[model samples]
Target: MNLEPMAGFLTFWAWWVAALVLAAVETVAPGAFMLWLGIAAGLTGFVTLATGLGWEGQLAVFAILAIVSVLWGRKWAKRHQGSGPSSVSRRADQLPGRAVVLVEPILHGTGRAELDDTVWLVTGPDAPAGTVMRIVRTEGATLIVEHIG
Candidate 1:
């Protein structure tokens, strides 16, 4: 109920302490949300130390900084969204142009081929078992191949 004592206890250093707490929270449960708030608090501490702003002004500055940092972070994330390394989990995408030996004879434009530890359904011209084929493309779970020799 009494605010005078609490208001006297809040200093510029209190903002810096709040920033550190927010940063620790960000590390434990991260999605960049608390990170921006921490940054805002850190900047507010610096501004408070330099300008000696009242509590009202400090709150205003922190609110503005938090909004700006979050919006900027979102825009930055969107711009870099497609610039990461290509996914290696899609085994089919990496199969094209690679050669594989047919494990089952192709009788009607379909057969099975072994590559690595997996057997893949293949579709192409008729080929005997043990014949080598190069993957040209993929159709769903099937590999489309062409004769290698």
Candidate 2:
């Protein structure tokens, strides 16, 4: 088989395609790792287009960019940590310090409280319905609370 055509196939479009694939994978199993690699691949495509580098040079550039981009992404993530969706699915984490009304009487140190649209299981001293309580902490899915005047 002639190797000339195959050598010409490693073009900017190839890199861009690789970048798209990496980005797609990131979407499927996201943890920010593949996203940075996708960015590196996309940038490498632009560099390849501008420099007309050979396969070896393109590979070298891609390696450097991938390493640098991943490290930079890690640093950027660290700096901006907790800036997005502070609690997201972990609603318990966001419950601390929030006051809620008891919907069900705390008959034996456990009751239901209503906050917004969801009902949360609370653990605290026995209290009657309509009592106000402040969340102190969480144990698993249960919120530990304290009564307030």
Candidate 3:
């Protein structure tokens, strides 16, 4: 068998090069989807080098790996996906469900509050300074404060 050509890939090096390039692009892209193809390509490269496979077999491996990788990634994400600000990697964790005192006295208008020495943009009805307020919700870095009246 002529080892110089494996389908469109010229020897195993072609697949190797393609896999490497895809892996690098995956880093720049930073997603599980592309990583799958990169891995599959790398695997195909090694397989090409290790064994003599026809184009049909190579294509079969590629398709199987792609489908499996994507499905695995999706399931992994689904199992790990979370709800609320707890999963969020930010300071938003310190705001939700916390008690705050009206520093500027919100009276039927917007105002701000400080919790744990952190200032948060708030929206609520009229209230005076020193009134106890609770953070009901958070919206895009803003806190939805409600007067505990």
What lDDT score belongs to each candidate, Candidate 1 first?
Answer: 0.87, 0.88, 0.75
Show where candidate 3 strays beyond 4 Å. 1-10, 80-94, 108-111, 116-127, 138-149
lDDT of 1 at 20: 94
State the TM-score for model 1: 0.72
Candidate with maximal TM-score: 1
Q: Give the clashing residue pairs of candidate 1, or none.
A: none
Over 1-149, each residue of candidate 3 has an lDDT whose tens digit, in order, gives 97455544564677778778887888888556777787787788778767767677887887888788778877877778743345446666556778987777785668878877777677888787777899988888778888675
Superposed by TM-score, candidate 1 places the C-alpha of residue 71 at a distance from the truth, in angstroms, of 2.8
Model 2: runs farther than 4 Å from truth? Answer: 1-35, 45-52, 80-86
Model 2: which residue pairs collide? none
How much is the lDDT of residue 45 in candidate 1? 86
lDDT of 1 by residue, 18-65 (tens): 999999999998677888898899989888877778889999999999
What TM-score does candidate 2 reach? 0.63
Off by over 4 Å in 1: 1-10, 78-86
